[model samples]
Target: MRNDFSNYFNNSSENKWYNSSYIGVSLSIPVFDGLQKRSKSRQAKLEYTRTGLILDNTKERFNVDFKNAINNYYNNKTNVERQNQNINLAEKVYVETALKYREGLASMSDLLQDEMGLSNAQASYLNALYNFKEAEINIMSLNGEIKYLINK
Candidate 1:
């Protein structure tokens, strides 16, 4: 009676066939063929190794960019400081030259030169400030710090 019941279930239309006959054979053949298995394993290892190297390169590149941005910011800051110093000196020179010209002791050309120097210094200082801000932004981007600042 048990055998009849088992046969009935095995032959029933509702019974789902897994078709696992080829599954074991397919799995065992790769192991039996040592060359194929070794080749596949080597390929997978190589792919993983390559992925690690790529990630390392990306990390190193970001580090380099961050360092460069830092250096740029410092350099721009130095430039701005120098420009400020120049503007201070130019102001004194411009004031003295203007007084001298009013007393007819200095030429108009000299006063004009002093004014131009002051203007140039002011422009350069503003440019340096802009550059410093941009460098800071770049560093933030490289460090992945700007993500929080994004609206999305």
Candidate 2:
């Protein structure tokens, strides 16, 4: 409804015109409330599905890393054990050669050669020990079981 009271005035008094005022009744109409809910639910479900997939992948990666760490631990243990055996055999040979030399059955050169072989074997053993320790540390770290001597 629009009303202008200035129209009731005479021409001379109506020189100032009053603006028409309007009162309106309005209603907000939703075009598709049901469709909006369906779309939002679908979008949420898709996001949830994506998050699940990402979590699954993360879990799989963790499992694979754990398995790899276990494999490395076993392999390192085997290597160290083999190296220790070789070192023991080399030590036995060195001792036998030294004894043979003392008894005048083997030359000094043979003793020295055995000594060198034993030294090389000891080096290999030490290297294997270090590798084993490193692998153990890696496995501990992977399993989240590493404890620091000095905690900060």
Candidate 3:
């Protein structure tokens, strides 16, 4: 009886100790949380779409602006060239008129008219040069190379 009682006590103590050292792993899957996670995911997706759309719109606007800038640059370049030609022609005419006036072949009025034409041509050339430079700056800006152009 004593042995049996001692063994029972020993077994009970061992069982208690073993049970105290128990380790358990549990997995908890969320079933419902007021749809907060779902809402956050939806919001994130919407923000992503909005960002993409903004990027696309900006790209389109940039393309259009670049095209317009290029067109203006070319137009101004042609105008500058035309104005330069006009200046050259006007200078030649003025020279010819001055020679004729000295030889008594051209009247003072004709010589003055040629001088006025030359002056007008020079002014137009300067204006065209200013416009061409402005257009060049615009082109450089549209190409994102304004700094480079300026530095050069």
Against the true structure, candidate 2 has what lDDT? 0.87
lDDT of 1 by residue, 1-152 (tens): 99989988888888877755543433433436758878999999999999999999998988888788899989988888888898898889999999999999999999999989889888888888888888888878877789978955
Model 3 lDDT at residue 135: 91
Q: Per-residue lDDT for 1-152 in model 2, tens only?
A: 12354444544564777799999999999986978899999999999999999999999999998898888889989999999999899999999999999999999999999999999998988998898899888887876667652353
Worst lDDT run of 10 residues, candidate 2, spans 1-10
How displaced is residue 46 in candidate 2, in Å? Answer: 1.7
Q: Which regions of candidate 2 fall more than 4 Å away from where they truly are?
A: 1-29, 33-37, 147-152
**How would you encode candidate 3's per-residue C-alpha lDDT over 1-152 as one tens digit per residue?**
99998888787765554335668999998788999998999999999999999999999999999899889989999999999999999999999999999999999999999999999999999999999999988887877798886788
**How do the predictions measure up, each by TM-score?**
0.72, 0.69, 0.73
Off by over 4 Å in 1: 1-34
